[model samples]
Target: MAEDPGTALVDQAVGYALLAMAGLRADALARATPCRGWDLGTLCAHLAESLVILRETVTGTPAVRACRPGRDPVAACRTEALRLARAWPAGGDGARPLAAVAATEVAVHGWDIARSLGACRPMPDGLAERLLRAAPALVGGGRAGLFAPPVAWPPDAPPGERLLALLGRRPG
Candidate 1:
């Protein structure tokens, strides 16, 4: 992990989110992701929207408008990522958990995007570790059913795969 886990998380999340979307094509919008019931387009929109909402929650700002028509999910995500990075206070301890949420959303949804795109790129281990530490608090609180029950992973699996398993995502 980096010196500041929060900043590192945001950096990792934004980069991966963008990378995942870069692989998206119009023809693939209807493709299935690892996330059940959500297609590629729907997951991308959710990830983009989540970033903006998370930023507002952490920055004490009013909610911004949802991604409107004529705005692609990738573009919206990039814009919100930049805005969130700027609005986020430096060394704000209270916002650390929010950062974790932002990172987790990006990473998990990045996985969905990548899976749909057949990219199969490895997720950063450090980011996965941070998300794993934050998961119980974020998902166990009132978000119970937000994720399915955790699946088992082999002990020798990579860090990202293990983290996804803990988050109830079955990583192939």
Candidate 2:
């Protein structure tokens, strides 16, 4: 059977929670990430805020109109992600439902925070397949330099590492 769209949101929740848990310690806040110049704290903040935005979108809340001023981004993201999951709705055809985008961000951004902090965490080999299958356009796409300079895997480089390089990130 084909995968349900809610699977994507679930994936995002998994990724989001994983990153938050693994990388949001006090030391992590002080650490910089590989996203050019984003500190881990700022990166998390951005992502958390983004999560709320995405949750609101999928939940059929009217466009936020404007971001509410001075809210805790992390709290907001966690709340929204939880809310989305608890209230999980049935998917109709063509529902965007926070699947690919969240997964991509969490996957990519998770590594970014790790590399910046000089900590090593494995990127799953399967991510390449998912990324390619879900959105080839993600390659050479986006605003550019979304992460640090892409890695160049020499022929001898591990396949997983090379694949990440192709996606515009240095392997962690």
Candidate 3:
């Protein structure tokens, strides 16, 4: 029904990884990103913690710490990318595999980071497009009424831009 939860999960994993790397080195900790006023470093740390949660979910294990904690957040995120590239954890009709979601997250967050750097590419196109298509449901079902602005999306914008615009970031 909803985007095979695994898909979203995996996408997020990938997205954060990309964000961590693609975001400007200086800006990675200072620039504002789509997640509102949170700087790049904070965003990366948040994403890193998120991945740890995903890893626990995928592994179906009981997690003590939600984030990697004290290690270099960026390096921890990069390590996740490497592992996720190798294999995604799967379950529930095989639709919400962790790897797939991780990939999607990586690509989109990469785009986000690129935008912050003023250097975004068009993406691989396919994955970004697919994420654009699914993001509404993924975002809407969970928290549409929670944080979206009173302003709606611009009618003619691309889906990625529209999605970012909705979240308070200028899209690439």
Q: Which candidate ranks first by lDDT, i.e. highest?
A: 1
Q: Encode model 3's per-residue lDDT on 1-172: one tens digit a residue.
A: 3555554555554655465375456325677766566666776676566666666666666544433456665666566555554345444564353344445456656665566566755554455556656665555645554435524668586655665565445564
What stretches of model 2 exceed 4 Å from their correct place?
Answer: 1-13, 16-20, 62-90, 96-98, 139-142, 145-149, 154-163
Error of 3 at 5 (Å): 13
lDDT of 3: 0.56
Cα RMSD (Å) per model?
2.5, 4.0, 5.1
Tell me the tens digit of each residue's lDDT in model 1 across 122-160. 788877777877887887756465887789999788878
After aligning candidate 3 to the native by TM-score, how far in Å is the CA of 154 from where it should be?
Answer: 5.1
How far out, in Å, is residue 161 in model 1? 0.4
lDDT (tens digit, per residue) of candidate 2 on 98-128? 4666566656665665576566765665654
Which number leads on TM-score? 1
Model 3, position 106: C-alpha lDDT score: 66
How many pairs of residues collide in model 3? 13
Better of 1 and 2 by TM-score: 1
